[model samples]
Target: MSKVIFITGGSSGIGKSIGEFLSEKGYVVYGTSRNPDNMKNHPFNLVALDVTNPKSISNAIAEVITKEGRLDVLVNNAGMGITGPIEDTPTDEMRKVFDTNLFGAIDVAKAVLPIMRNQKSGLIINVTSIAGYMGLPYRGIYSATKGALELVTEAMSMETKRFGINVTNVAPGDFATSIASGRYHTPIFENSAYKENYQLNLDLMDAHVDEGGDPIEMAKTVYEIINTKNPKLHYKVGDFMQKFSIVLKRILPDRMYEKLLMNHYKL
Candidate 1:
């Protein structure tokens, strides 16, 4: 029997790629997007969902279960990016970012856990980012959201282990996606305190996106993780440089790592 996988944020980018790739691999994939009208006749089942809305998530999951009878995998891939200095960022925007990236994932997981626990088998993959493991200048709030998600994935993995459920956090580094380009931008020149640092941060992000790794490769890595009989707690996918950078960040001193990032981004 084909396994059923449910994913959020599947309208585009990495989530969309994963949905297509997995469906081609014979999985009964159900992907959720905020606007389902534009997703008609897609390769996979596209359901209308707004990650920030608990009712929307609950209804989508209930609809899937009603038709499929079982959900073997859940991918918390819905998220958005907000970039600006921590002090300059609006408090309401910061909360919105966390609502979608962290709390939203938590809500979806909570809704799906009962079904998985009852079935005594399932996999939960939380799509995090390299930012989750390390912080950057303009991405303070975004990093915090991902960092919280990574920690949640760790705790959830431990809690779900005995129930035959596998929770894996996949952290991809600087993938070539519209996420970076589509990030919410606020004019730092308007804020006297952040004016001096505004251009520097903007240039840094542009350079990073120019050299980002391929999203398709990240999608392939996700496919591999899903097919694995026993998935690991975390999977890092990206170019060789990204893997090396992560290693250096893990092993080097704080000052050294900071200097490396500064030099790499020329910030």
Candidate 2:
């Protein structure tokens, strides 16, 4: 039988691309959305799932197992975006992003572990972001969420290996998607501290996403990782500069790298 694949946040964007690609490759693909009823004419199966809700996560996984008897691959792609100066972004808003981007992914992964253990095999791929590698201006919250997931994936990879389940993360740079519209933006308050710079960075971010590479590239990378017998703990998919920035961070001094990022964002 073809591998049964489960992808979160599959209604659109990177998740949708991954689901469609895998389905075409003959995998049994089940994608999740908060309101599956509203999404029509989708290629792969989409079940109602809200990752922030533990009960919803469990129900959706149960539904998948009931239909397929096994889930061979899980693409933990459900996440939201947030942008604002760290100080200006409300505490509750920060918590909300963490709930959805970090805790949500963890809960979904926890739900799938037992089933994969019993089957003696499975793969979990967390969709992180290139922004996670550094703290970008006005996008600090979004960066922290994905960055935390990256580290968690590392720890989970070590723990799950003995159980025959593989875990990894794919950090993609800006991809043409609906993320901009979906992300929370702390309004550019007129008299607030960071008015001019904040607005400029926001415009810059939109441009990057607007000119981003195709989501199909992310799908292809995920497909390649899924097929590997011993995939690495972390993978990055992006253009030369985007991926290289990570490398630069590793080799550069603390203040120097900070300076580089500040220059890039014109902060």
Candidate 3:
């Protein structure tokens, strides 16, 4: 039987690309969207799922398993983006992002583990971000959520290995997608302290996304990880510099890495 694959946030962006690619390769693909009815003519299956809601997560997973009898892989890709000065960003907004990015992913994994454990085989791939490796100006909260998930993936992998469940993270850099449009950007208040630098960095961020690599690159990377005998704990997909930034952080001193980022953002 072909492996059954389920992807969260699959109505569009990287999740949609992954689902379509896998469907074409003969895998049973089920993707989720908060408003599945709004999405039209999608190639593979699209189910209703709201990661932030436990009931929704359970129901979606159950629906997939009920139809396929087994779920072999889960791509935890349902996430939203946020950008703002740490000081100015609303605390409630920060919690909201954390709820969706970190806790939501965790809840989804929690729902799947029991089923996988019974089968004695499964894989969970958390979609993180290159930003997760380090804090970025105007995007600190977004970075923190993804960073926390990365560490969680590490701890969960160790805990779940005995049960034949593989857990890992895929941190992608800027990709040409609708993410920018959906991202919650704390207003650049005219009188706020960070107005100038914040606006500048916002433009820079948009430019990077506009010129970023294709989403298919990430989809192909996910497919490879699924087929690997023993995949690494973390995988990153992006342009050379985006991936290299992580290496630079390791080898360079703290201030030096900070300087590079400030210079790039023209701060």
Candidate 4:
């Protein structure tokens, strides 16, 4: 029997690309969306899923398990982004971001852990972002969510190590996707303190995302991770400049690294 893989937020963007790529490679792939009918043309199987809802997540996974009897991989790719200065971002909005990006992924992963343990094998790939390594202006909430998820994945790796399970974090920098359009922005009024800087940074960041690296590269990376029996804990995908930042931050002095990032964003 073919290996079974379930991907969240698979109706479009990177999730969709990964699903199709893995399917072509012979894995039985199931992709989830809030509306399955709209994604019928997608190459992989479509299941209705709202990661934020426990019932929806359980139902989706149960549907897959009922037919497949086993889930070899779980890709927690369902997430949303938000932009604005952290101070200006409302409490509710921040919670909403975490609800989807952080908690939703955890909920789904929890639901699948037992199944994978029962089978005595599985892989969990959490689609995090480069921001998880460091915070970015105007994307503070988004960064916090990814950063939290990264830590969760790290701890999960340790806990699941003996279960014949593997977990990997795929952190792509500025991939060309629907993320910008799908993200929520904090409201800015004339009195807003960071309004001007926020607008400037948001526009520049949006351009980077529009011209960001190909999602196909990320798909290939995911495939490689899946094929590796002992995959690395973290895989960063994007241009050299973005990838270099990860290293630069580690070696450079705190103030110097902060200065470099500030200059890059023209803060």
Candidate 5:
């Protein structure tokens, strides 16, 4: 029997790639997006889903369950980014980011847990970022959202392990995705403090993402994990720079790490 997999944010970027990859591998992939018409048809099913809305989440799941009796995998990949200095970001916008990235994942997991628990077997993969592990200047709010996901995935892994379910958190470094460009940004005060410095940090981060790793690499990693009999709790995928950044965070002193980031960003 073919395994059924449900994916959120499957319209573009890494989610789209992962959906396509898994479907080709013979999994019954059910992907979700806010606008299903915009998504190009693949080998799997596409359903309308909006993570921020509980009704939308429930309806999508119901539709899938109605068609397929069992779900073998759930990939919580739907997320948005908010880039700006922490102090400059409005509280409303910050909350919106978390609503989509963190709470959204939780909502999906909550809805799917019962089915997985009843089945006594399943895998949940949360698509986090390197920001989940380390914070960056100007992108503090975005980092916080991913950080929340990382911690949630950790606790979820422990809680679900005994139930025969696996929860894996994937923290990919800068990938060639539309996240940097497609992110919704609110303008900071034109004459406010840190405007110049904040702009500089945003520019640097954008440049790095423009020249980052391939999305297909991350997609391949997701496919590999899904095929594994026993998936691990966490995985990191990126180029050499990302690996080095993780290492620096591990060994370097706090002040030294801050200094390194400052120099790297040319702040």
Candidate 6:
């Protein structure tokens, strides 16, 4: 039987790319968006789903299972971004980012775990970020969300091990996508403490992100993970420098690492 796959946030970006790529690979694919109308022209099945809503998550999974005998893979790729200093970011705004990036992914995983547990085989890949390993200016909250998700993936690996379920946290540095268009930037004023360097930080952040590698590269990585007999706990997709930074942080002293980041951001 062909493998069955379900992807969240499939309207565009990494999610959509993965869905399309995997479909071409001959798997049964179901991609979800809160507004399926937005994806009407897409080739694969498009289901209306809201990751932040439990009922919507449950229903989407049910739709996939009802149509396909079993779900072989669940890719939690739906996420949102927030920018600006933490102090400038409102509490409610942080909550919104966390809801979509972290909590929502958690809920969707919970919704699918039961089905996989019963089947005794499945793979859960949560798309995290390279920022999760290091804190970045103007994107602190976004970093926190990814960091928390990575930790959750670690704990979950152990929790679902006995059930023959696989969980891997895929941390991407930056991929060419519509992510910048969806960011919730914190309000900044003329008198703001970060005003002088705010725009520069934002520019630096954007420059790298805008230059991010193609999303198909990540989709290919996901494909490899799916076919591999034993996938590792974590996989990172991005530029060499970004991946190197993870290693540098590990070996370099704390102050040294912070200095490197400060210089790179021109702070």
* Model 6: lDDT of residue 68: 85
- Per-candidate TM-scores read 0.95, 0.99, 0.99, 0.98, 0.96, 0.98
Local lDDT at 136 for model 4: 85
For each candidate, the alpha-carbon lDDT, in order, equals: 0.87, 0.95, 0.95, 0.92, 0.87, 0.91
Tens digits of per-residue lDDT, candidate 6, 1-267, equal: 899999999889999899999999999999889999865689688999998899999899999988887999999999999998877779999999999999999999999999999999999999999999988888889999999999999999999999999999889988888898889977677788888788888877778778989999889999999999889999999899999999999999999999999998888
Ranked candidates (lDDT, high to low): 3, 2, 4, 6, 5, 1
lDDT of 3 at 261: 92
Please, what are the lDDT tens digits per residue for candidate 5 over residues 238-264?
A: 887777788889999999999998898
lDDT of 4: 0.92
Clashing pairs in 6: none
lDDT of 3: 0.95
Q: Which regions of candidate 2 fall more than 4 Å away from where they truly are?
A: none
Model 5 stretches astray by more than 4 angstroms: 40-43
RMSD (Å) of each candidate, 1 decimal: 1.5, 0.6, 0.6, 0.9, 1.3, 0.9
Error of 5 at 178 (Å): 1.5
Which portions of model 6 miss their true places by more than 4 Å? Answer: none
